[model samples]
Target: MSDEDLRLSADRVLARLVGDPTDSARLREDQWRAIEALVAERRRALVVQRTGWGKSAVYFVATALLRERGSGPTVIVSPLLALMRNQVDAAARAGIRARTINSANTEEWDTIQAEVAAGEVDVLLVSPERLNNPDFRDQVLPQLAAATGLLVVDEAHCISDWGHDFRPDYRRLRTMLADLPQGVPVLATTATANARVTADVAEQLGTGEGTGRALVLRGPLDRESLRLGVLPLPDAAHRLAWLADHLDELPGSGIIYTLTVAAAEEVTAFLRQRGHTVASYTGKTENADRQQAEEDLLANRVKALVATSALGMGFDKPDLGFVVHLGSPSSPIAYYQQVGRAGRGVEHAEVLLLPGREDEAIWRYFASLAFPPEEQVRRTLDVLAASDRPVSLPALEPQVELRRSRLEIMLKVLDVDGAVRRVRGGWTATGQPWAYDAERYAWVARQRETEQQAMREYATTADCRMEFLRRQLDDEKAAPCGRCDNCAGVRFTTEVSAASLDAARGELGRPGVEVEPRRMWPTGLPAVGVDLKGRIPADEQAAPGRALGRLSDIGWGNRLRPLLAPQSPDAPVPDDVAGAVVTVLADWAKGPGGWASGAPDAPDRPVGVVTIASRTRPQLIGSLGERIATVGRLPLLGSVAYHDGEIDTRVPRTNSAQRLRALHGALTVPPPLAAALAEAGGPVLLVDDLADTGWTLAVASRLLRRSGAAGVFPLVLAVQG
Candidate 1:
């Protein structure tokens, strides 16, 4: 075709994509170059462009062009569900039929597969994890690979370990790439990758034997519209108060990012209490609820969605007015990726960071869950090889000494490396020898440390914030953008009113969070000699309890952090904290989700108090129980003693099964306590300083039930969620 003809076809696609042929939506020259390389030359290409720079348009146009020329459907491998949804909707505007196959809509997978095979689907969006799903990988992936016209890896930086949000499932893309037919084009796109990640992903794009030279089109990693600033708050309460005061001042509906799910929920609740319309989006959020929250934010039905990183990378609202962070992310790359959500389609979007003292602590907590030692990986392989059967994740949890989340992460990495294979029932050893790369993981961890330091610098730097961030991403053209606080002077203020501050202090200082009892026993307990399985009997289970606060909550969490933090010396419950506990008790008696707030009927109030013996914080636990007993005028029943002193429950910090093993027969009800409980003939308030895994509480509750306590009402200073 002639150049004019090509330009006309492109413009027509762009118009369709934008849902307006006369909007004059034209592609940038770089975008056209990416499309031409993918469509005409059928070469591998990587596009490292800023957000809202028409990266999606390049792929959509390439798909249209490839389809017009009778190539098979484009398969887009994306990392997030929100992104998949956004892509589907965006594709529809361009008259491109897009179907997604993700975990949320498993029932529609068959239909989506049929549509793709029948040539009715223009763009097929699938999560990277789908590549490892037994049914999808075995039954559908092969056919999809053979028929795929163009393969697009969205957020392709995730394919590299150097990427801040690296996902192991993305590594499976290499197998798909190798399976594709000759001369098929492949495109990888990311806005967050530094030079190292880009080079690594580019190598993956070069994996196809018949694929020719790869084209790398990298643009300046700078957003002129974002005005970045950092407000260094003294504590979580002040940070939250600032938000409550200034949320109305932010231009449009946007996201409020928190570091943890609990933080997200807590912030959402606090914001709503402050009379702002908002919702929470985190990994724990139900898929349907998450979809609704995304819609609510997109439609401006809510002022903001208080969210964790779960809301990052795929929810699109071109006119997002602002982005705020409650805590600093561990790295500048990840931080930039999140703040990029703002000022995408609109000019002059406000981006603010309220960095807290707790930010580094949260960062350290995440750092601890990184890749495990080589021995643990070997142990996992040994167990899987010895099993001679596919061992599900739950079953594997008992045999492997790793925490569930970290273990699953390891298993996924192993699966991608061909060291293990996920099958019908679960995962099995692949009999492929794999050497653990200690140096790589160590390097990644070190990189994380460096990035964290950089984030600290980014927060306090006198230089331009955007320039600092761009430099962190290794942008060669990095220069002061003169738009951030350092360049333009403090743009967002930290000022908050006394009334607002008082409200925040009251909210944060007011202790007591609902401590949900564990309903079901973890599976595979029998393997660990615990003999427990299925649901815990209601008669033996601890009732829904109360805690002074969550360890992740911005309010009480800040106060509790120092007191309950690791290496902190244990002593009697401090006077102010004990007073807070008194406040918590007073509120718990009438609190919405607390013990006395039962819906069908008013729940039984504690008639007696019983302390759980603590090895680490005996004084704290003992004093807390005495205070509750003294304040409530209830009998202080003698404590539950450690019958088997051989085991330390928190030593390994293992999974549920192992935790149960540690707690099995570990507690003994004192004879006097047992007598007091029988005499009281009512619910007993069980006190402890911290509830980490709830197994200790579970074990204690079981003993209390066996010893004839009418009900076990477990209470704690902090509940780790």
Candidate 2:
């Protein structure tokens, strides 16, 4: 086709994409180059551009043109459910049919697949996770690879481990790429890949070694419409106060980004109490609720959605007025990506960061969950290899000490590395020799540390905040963005009122979070030599417990976290902490379903007190027990003892089954305490410093019940999630 003819053809597609007349919509030069590579040249391409830079337009346009030429349906590997929904809608505006097969719509997948087979679908969207499904991989993916006209990897940075949001499921795309028929052009798209991540993703996009000469289209990472600033808050209370005071002043309905689920919920509650209409969006939210929250945000029905990274990547709200971070993300690349969500479809949008003192601690906590050490990896492999049958995750947990989430992550990595295969029943060892990539993993960790430092620099730098973030992404053209606070001076007041501050302080200082009792024991305990399995007998279980605060909460948790952190010297419980515990008890006595609530099912007041002896925090736990017993005048039964004085330190075990083993016979009730339990014949306050895996309380509660207690009421200083 002649160049002018191609330009006119692209213009018509652009018009459809934007719902404008053909002459009013035209592709930029760089966008045209990307189109040429994908359509005319049939070449692989990686387009690294900023948000609102028409990356989607390029793909949708290409899809329309390709479908017109009688190509097979375009397969798009999208990351989030939100992203898939938005893309499907955009494809429709461009007059292209798009169907998605994701976890949210299991019932419609068969119909969607049939439509694709019948050539009724122009584009198909599938999440990275779906690529690993046994049925899809065995039946659908092979046929799709052979017939797919073009493969699009949305948020392709996920393919690189170096990327801030690397997903192992995305790495599974390698097998799909290798299976694609020759000349099936592939396109990788993202707005946040730094140089290392870009190179990594480009390398993976290749169908073969020499043939992988992808057309790389790089664009400047600058948001002309965003005005950036950072305010260093002294504490969480001050930060919450600042948001509560100034949230209504921001432009349009926006988002408040928090670092933890507890923080998200806390912020949402505080804002609502302050009369702001907001909702919480986190990984814990149900799909239906998440959809409603997204819709509310999109329609401006609410002021904002207080969300974690769960609301990120592809939530489409053009003219979103502002984005405020309650705490900064660990990496500048990630921060830049998140803030980019603002100012995309508006003339000007506000981007502010209220970094808290607890931010680094949260960062370190997350870093601790990164890829495990070589020994741990090898131990997992050994467990899988020892068994002849495929082992389900629940069944494998008893044999390995990793938590369910982390263990699942490790298995996915192993699956990608060809060390294991996820079959119909579960996972099986492939018997293929696998070598640990120590150097590579170490490099990724170090890179993370470096990125964390860069974010710190971005927060404190006197230079333009946008320029600092741009430099972190290795955008060589980065320059001073005059719209930021550093370049234009502070545009908003950081000062908050004494009343607001006091209100926030009161809310945060008020402590006590309900900790639901574990009903079912970790699955697969029998395989590891433990007798416990299935639903914990109701008779042997602990009643729902109460903790002063969650270890990740922005409130009292901050005060408790440092004292309980590793290597901290043991000390007596502080006076204020003791008072808070008393307050918690008083509230427990008077709160709903409490002993005073008069509900028939309410648990009876704990008649006697029992303390779980802590190996490291013995002084703290002992003081807590003594003070509570002294104040309430309840008899203090001699404490449960770790047999042989060998304490089962909660730090070493990462998962439930391991903790159960370490605690099984690790605690024995003193004969006097057992006798006291029989005499009291009512619930006892089980005092402990912390509850990590909850196995200690479960086992202890079981023992106390067998000794004749009516119920166990657990009260802990903190709940470590």
- Give the best candidate by lDDT: 2
- CA lDDT scores, all candidates in order: 0.87, 0.89
Tell how far residue 268 is off in model 2, in angstroms: 0.4
In terms of lDDT, the poorest run of 10 residues in model 2 is: 644-653
The residue-by-residue lDDT of candidate 2 on 1-721, one tens digit each, is: 7768877898899998888963589899989999888888889999999988989999888888888888898999998889888888888888899999999999999999999999999999999999998999999999899889889999999999999998999989999988888888899999999999998888888765344577889999999999999888788899999988999899998999999999999999998998899999999999999999999999999999999999879888888999999988999888888888888889999999988778888999899889999898888889889888988988887777788889989899999999998899899999999999999999999998998898888889999999889998999999999999999999889789898899899999998988788888887777777788889899999988899999888999889888888788998899999999999988988888787677888888888889988888889999899899888889887688887767866435588887887787778988889998888889899999888888888989998988888988889989985
Candidate 1's displacement at residue 508, Å, is 1.2
**Predicted candidate 1 versus true structure: per-residue lDDT over 252-360, tens digit per residue:** 9999999999889878888899999999999999999999999998899999999999988887899999999999999999999999999888879999998887788
The residue-level lDDT of candidate 2 at 148 comes to 96
- Clashing residue pairs in candidate 2 are none
- Candidate 1's TM-score reads 0.96
Top TM-score hit: 2
CA displacement after TM-score superposition, residue 331 of candidate 2 (Å): 0.5
